[model samples]
Target chain A: MDEFSFIDSIKPDSYRQSSLIKGIDDDAAVFRQNTQDIVTAVDTMVDGIHFSRETMEPYSIGYRALAANLSDLAAMGAEPAFFMVSIVIPSDWAEQELQEVYRGMASLGDGYRMDMIGGDTVSGKEFAISITVFGYVERNKARYRTAALPGDILFVTGTLGDSRAGLECINKKIDNEYLIQRHCQPSPRITFAEQLSSFNRVALNDVSDGIASEGSEIAEASCVDLHIAYDSIPYHSSIAELFPNQYQEWILSGGEDFELLGTISEREWPEVQQKAEELNLSVTKIGYVSEARESKGLVYLTMDGRTERLEKSGYTHLQEGRD
Target chain B: MDEFSFIDSIKPDSYRQSSLIKGIDDDAAVFRQNTQDIVTAVDTMVDGIHFSRETMEPYSIGYRALAANLSDLAAMGAEPAFFMVSIVIPSDWAEQELQEVYRGMASLGDGYRMDMIGGDTVSGKEFAISITVFGYVERNKARYRTAALPGDILFVTGTLGDSRAGLECINKKIDNEYLIQRHCQPSPRITFAEQLSSFNRVALNDVSDGIASEGSEIAEASCVDLHIAYDSIPYHSSIAELFPNQYQEWILSGGEDFELLGTISEREWPEVQQKAEELNLSVTKIGYVSEARESKGLVYLTMDGRTERLEKSGYTHLQEGRD
Candidate 1:
């Protein structure tokens, strides 16, 4: 079939939102969401660079691609409403495999009522998927990394290093279903981020890259120093037992965690924990923001009454810096 | 540099619109435009599948990629506003060459005041660029292919087949600067489309995949038959002079024209011509819509008082169909 025919075969028959006046039929998709500000995030995942067939199933590949974009919106405290996907297919891929990819996305998006409005499908040598997600946040209420202030308590949602460890487990052929599932299915901290918007100001960043990279970003953007207590950062017990020497490396610098890392005021820290508890989420306070000293926007790891710069250790694609 | 640093290096230092609350610094770009309905179009161009270094310059590739998406929004009569880009860079490409790509997009977008809001940059094996554009149209005023009715006058803006001929010239190592320029630089009929949107109802489509595919799309969507006069279809004089035998084929099936095709009320035909004259746009009355007679939504080409079905003649990626 032609590109148009394939698009016709895959386009959603009916959209859930009346606001989505146009979907895939027209030259462009049309929609209006008037109640709040609009937030958009676009992410691209390639076959070799982002995932490999040996390690990632088609469904998990699709799921994680959308999940990464969703995590970005979650960090901004945006409620995702609509998404568009642009996928490049290789000739070897079957039509059924493509449907599995869509099914994977629907499994996640249907829960949030997010509609797949429009996208482009084309044949290429390598398989790649690019997803652009749109969401709404309250007017002028979208959280930013610059919102952190001195005396704010730094916190993270869920355990860190799970995704990186999970990826290692998959590569090593280790029999750890929990770790494998963690690598494949990352849950964006949307609920916690939504509640975070109620606070006066909370600097939020998602842990796609390791905490070292993410914490450094927040510090640089807010022009404040972050003092992370090394012993306080949480991780899965299995990761420590299985890879004791490398567990600290993964906890500090392993990427693709998809957890929320934010700095909130000391006064509101208790309330934030209570809300996380109410939602049955694991919220851990690992650090605090402080006025920049000695150097601007630096992150320090404090353990055993000794302080040292937290070095970025994750793999970087084009150069020697953590993601 | 790493992905984040590369993004920081290329992101716009300042934005023209206050509606853009956030740009590249955040996880997602946040913006609010309350005046009109939003229109979004996304297009992806790959190195080997869409174009190659042998036939296309990096700048033209970038320019044409954005142009195609802008043309989509134009077909819907949406005023272009902002766009985000997701690009995959191969190891061979230099940073300067990448900047040229951005320069190509900026050359067109700056004229329309469209801002580069946000996107992701990643490393991959092959070079690819996907652009997602956002525009605004008057509430419920956007045009669609389904709006055509019987007795509506069909029109097309600008000459067709130049791009296809240009591609042939490049492949054959022919030095025809005019055709090559026409192939590389396609001016979207945004001004004409904006004017057309003032009418009550007009069915519209962009001549991206040639008139055979585009006209058929409008016909099928509107559930009407289109009678196109073969003699009235406009083409560059050079095409007929240079390749007399294949000119008709190119005119009918040559894709990437980036011109607007629409059907409007017969009463508004004269006014449309007048507006075209005012705007210095070449608008041709080549056909009219009719009730579906023998076959629903079929397109017939008439020449010498004889009519024939217009078959799709362009190349398909995975199967046999145009575009």
Candidate 2:
């Protein structure tokens, strides 16, 4: 088949009418919207490293590739819009597999109104997916990492570490499908995060690298220290027995939870709490941001009122030699 | 590292700000321009299929990968503004090789103000690079493949078959450095291709899959057939005499020529000729779009006025067993 004919067979036009100015046979796909609070982020997933060959499903991988990118948009207090995907697949992959992969990509991609305007495909030894998403936020109300100030109340969306706990549950001879699903599927807080945009949000980050690591990133970026009341962190009632210790490890170090970690001013606490309710998300004011503290780390206040610095709990590249 | 600091390491501000919008930490890199004429294209080069470890310098491969994408923008008469790269390198590639690869990519990338907005990287068994470039033309004036009308003349830039000749020279006893350079460091006629956009006069595409093949693509896309004058097809003067029979084969089937092959109306031929001279490129009127007289295929006219159907010349995805 000819080049254009082969390209036509791919047919990436499901969500084209929403914002794409031009789809194919053009230099770049044009997307336009009036007024501007633009939010954009990029994420790529690869086989073997990010996903194991034994455990990875092609359809799920395709879905997760787009999911991770859109989630980044959601974390920024922005509504997702258009997205561009680039893929490299093994030449030996069957056409049926390629179609199924697209089916999975479109499943998630269409719901978010992400017009698959452009993409590239080529032969490679391993499969890789790279996605870039563009979103728009209200100009003055963009939740920013730099906005976090001292005395701001800290909060997280949803239950802490269920996704991580799910991983452990799967490993410990627990014949549970829920835990594996939790690790494979990531439904980030998009609607809930956007509602918090106008709450004078001081700092923001997606907990892709666990809440502890991302919280540290926010602190570093905003130049403020966080003192979280660890005991106050919400948890699922299922693992209520070891929930405290497990939650600390999972919520603090578990990557891929895709939960949002951000701070808001004390004055805006009531509004944030009300907004969280409307979104069906659990919003907890775990602690406060401090200008300086005895420990420049997470501070956990015991139920008895004693406070101590939290230990670093996150994946390091050097954990088992360089990754 | 800080988020911005991490971004800074990839593209310094002095270079990042060179484009219309800085890509670092922006919601979306703003691409402000007055013209609605836009051109966009994407291409990828894989390490084993496109370049082998023994024959290619990784840095040169990196530069060439980027150059090939820019060539597509040129074919559409677009000036490249920015690009995104997706790469997967083998585990064995040293950190310095990675830096050198970026050095080459950035060198070519920076020259065109194509900010490396973002990229995806992972460890793989082989090295691969995919790039998508954005360029602009006036809306109606942007060149396209289906623009060729009946009786429109065909023109191509530069000499054909040079890349194929170079490829042959690399695998043989041809002791010519010139051929090796042309094959390994094929120049993507960016400025020249962008210039063609200004004329905005006809169907165009870069000669990636040989002039004969890409010419047919334009004809087929436009739904008009073509009749070519075989004698008018230009050849690299240096290799024209050494192997006359093989020279024709290279000119006809040699891929990766990286020259522009396009169509123009009889009325626009004068402007096309003048622009060719201005750019110091060899512009040859090799064919004309027509309604097929005998069989429904592109025809090639010999110097004696005898005509026959054009043959497809270049790389094909179908393996021997598949056909």
Candidate 3:
């Protein structure tokens, strides 16, 4: 089918929102939000680099592409409003495959109450999808990675290492449904971010490049030192049971968990924890921010109680060959 | 270089605006505009399909990718604010080549006072750049292609067929600087759009997919028939001087001129023409919107004064194989 026909077939009428002035069938999409601040992010996923067609379904690819961008907005304590997707598919791909991709995106978009407003569909030598998410936050309420104070307590929402473990499960042909699902469709911690931002959290970031990398980023951005306790870092229960030996490595260095990692003041820690409990979320206090000393930035207390510098290494696409 | 290092090295310190709350080094970029309405557009350009690496520079590729999206915003009569780029580059490309791409985008971004806010860079089998531009238009002042009425005069900003002629020059090794530059870096009609929109255009569209296709689009959207005069259609001077035989074909069916095409009521035509002249822009009256009858939408008059139905065939990516 042609481009227009394909777009028309998948166009969702339910995407209309009061804020949207215009949607598809125009040169550009128009919208309005009352909030004074807007959070925007763009992410691209390549077939071989981000996922493999052999392992992932087309729907999962589409879902994960938007999930990655939504995760960025979540980290910024922004409520997702809408997103645009630009997809370049291989010439050989069938119309059904493209439809499935949109279906997957619609499913996730519906859950987030965000619309797929506008985008471009083109032909390329390989399959790639680029998603741009727009979200809103009140002025001065949008969280940043540059506000963690020396006395801030660090916390993370949801378990880590599951996505990495899921990848391992797929590679090893392990029959771990949860692990594979986690890898294929990791959820963005939007609600957790909303709850934490309501309490005016300090620094915020999503654990996309492993806890180690994210911790260092917060430390560098806020001009502070981070002290993480290895035992306090929450690992997926499946990881501990299925691959106990790799739990620490996966929890500290594994990526694509899409969990919110942030810092809060000591005074607000109790209330933040209570709020997380109210939200029925698994929020864990795993570290503390301190003034930069001789060995500035990320330092970790090992399981054996020895302090060591945490390496700023994780899922750097240029180095690791994947997102 | 790793992803972090590459991102840090090219990170523009000058991108910071008073409206930009946060930029790179965070999970997402944050910004706010005082305008009540926001306009967004996205376009993706593939390396081989959109422009071959042998014929185009990396910088031109980057510039054109963003330019395409900006053109869409221009068609909406929006003021350019910021844009994000998601790039997938082959692993074999040199770091300098990648830097050149950013430099190209930075050049255009600086011209429009638009920030390169945030995006993702990943490895792909081939090079592709997807750009999402965010702009703002005053509420009720934004232009649309669906608002034209019967007896509205069609006017296009700037000369047409230059970009296509430029492409032909490059393909045939014609060594025409004007044609080549027009093809490589066609300017988006933002200034013209800003001027004409002040006069309240009835309908608007960018001439991306040839005059015939765009004219048909505006006609169909507005539910009116467009009667275009063949002699009034503007062609670039270079096309007339260098390739006179192909001038008609290029003006009628060529794509990627990035010029604004729109309709204005006959009552507003004089004021619109004055505004275009004040802006030093070329605005030509080429057609008029008529009430839809049996053969509704688009029709054209030949040079000999004979009428014919205008075909909707232009640059459909699925049929043409690329943008």
Query: B35-74 in candidate 2: lDDT tens per residue?
Result: 4543455566777777766676767787878877777777
Model 2, residue A217: what's the lDDT?
65
TM-score of 1: 0.95
List, for all models, the DockQ compared with the true complex. 0.76, 0.34, 0.77
Local distance difference test, each candidate: 0.86, 0.67, 0.83
Worst 10 residues of 2 chain B by lDDT: B314-323
lDDT of 3 by residue, A146-185 (tens): 8899998999988999998998898888999998988889
How big is the positional error of residue A78 in model 1, measured in Å on the Cα after superposition?
0.6
True-structure Cα RMSD, model 1: 3.4
- The chain A TM-scores for the candidates, taken one by one, are 0.94, 0.84, 0.93
Candidate order, DockQ descending = 3, 1, 2
Better of 2 and 3 by DockQ: 3
Q: Which 10 residues in a row give candidate 1 chain B its minimum summed lDDT?
A: B314-323
Q: Candidate 3: where is the Cα deviation over 4 Å?
A: A294-296, A315-323, B294-296, B299-303, B315-323
Model 1 per-residue lDDT tens digits across residues A1-323: 45555666667777887668898888889998777899998999999888886678888988898899999999999988889999888888887778778878888888788899888887788888999999999998898999999999999999988888898888889878888888898998887799877787888999988898889889988999998998999999999987887777888888898999999999999999999999999999999999988566878887666677775544232122221
Docking class of 3: medium
Write down the lDDT that model 1 would get: 0.86
